[model samples]
Target: MDKHLIDDIKHVSLSLFNKNFFGVYHGSISARVSASGFIINSKDTILDEVTEESLVRLDCQKRDYRWSMANADVHIHEHIYET
Candidate 1:
């Protein structure tokens, strides 16, 4: 992913957290990276303190569970990407 994009996600996540839009370990953020792939925040990640390491890449075409940091709402993000 591009450094600027990643930074933007982090900034937004932090802003949302700071504004009480998403509490600690509550909400999630995601960005479509390709036609069949995207990056989403990990489960239990504090939105106020999001880091690059807190993001997980997922393949929308396949139902793979190999990622340890994948968020619980990953399916939702995938569905959005599909549309």
Candidate 2:
């Protein structure tokens, strides 16, 4: 992903946290990286404390766990990518 886009995601995440839109353990954020993949927040990640480690890359077609940890709602994210 582009450095600027990753920075934007981080910026928006912090904004959401500040507004209480996403609590420490309650929300997920994602961005489409390709036609078949995206980068999403990990399960239990605190939106207010997101780091590069907090993001997990997933491939919609392969359904592979590119990262060691992933969100429970990964399938939903994948479904969105599929369409």
RMSD of each: 1.5, 1.7
On TM-score, the leading prediction is 1
Error of 1 at 40 (Å): 0.2
Evaluated against the true structure, the overall lDDT of model 2 is 0.81
What lDDT tens digits, residue by residue, belong to model 2 across residues 5-50? 7788899999999999998888778889988889989996888877
| lDDT by residue (tens digit), candidate 1, 1-83 | 67887899999998888899898888889998888888999896888887888888888777666355688777777789984
Error of 2 at 47 (Å): 0.6
* Cα lDDT for residue 33, candidate 2: 92
* Pairs in clash, predicted candidate 2: none
List where candidate 1 sits over 4 angstroms from the true fold. none
Worst 10 residues of 2 by lDDT: 60-69
Error of 1 at 6 (Å): 0.9
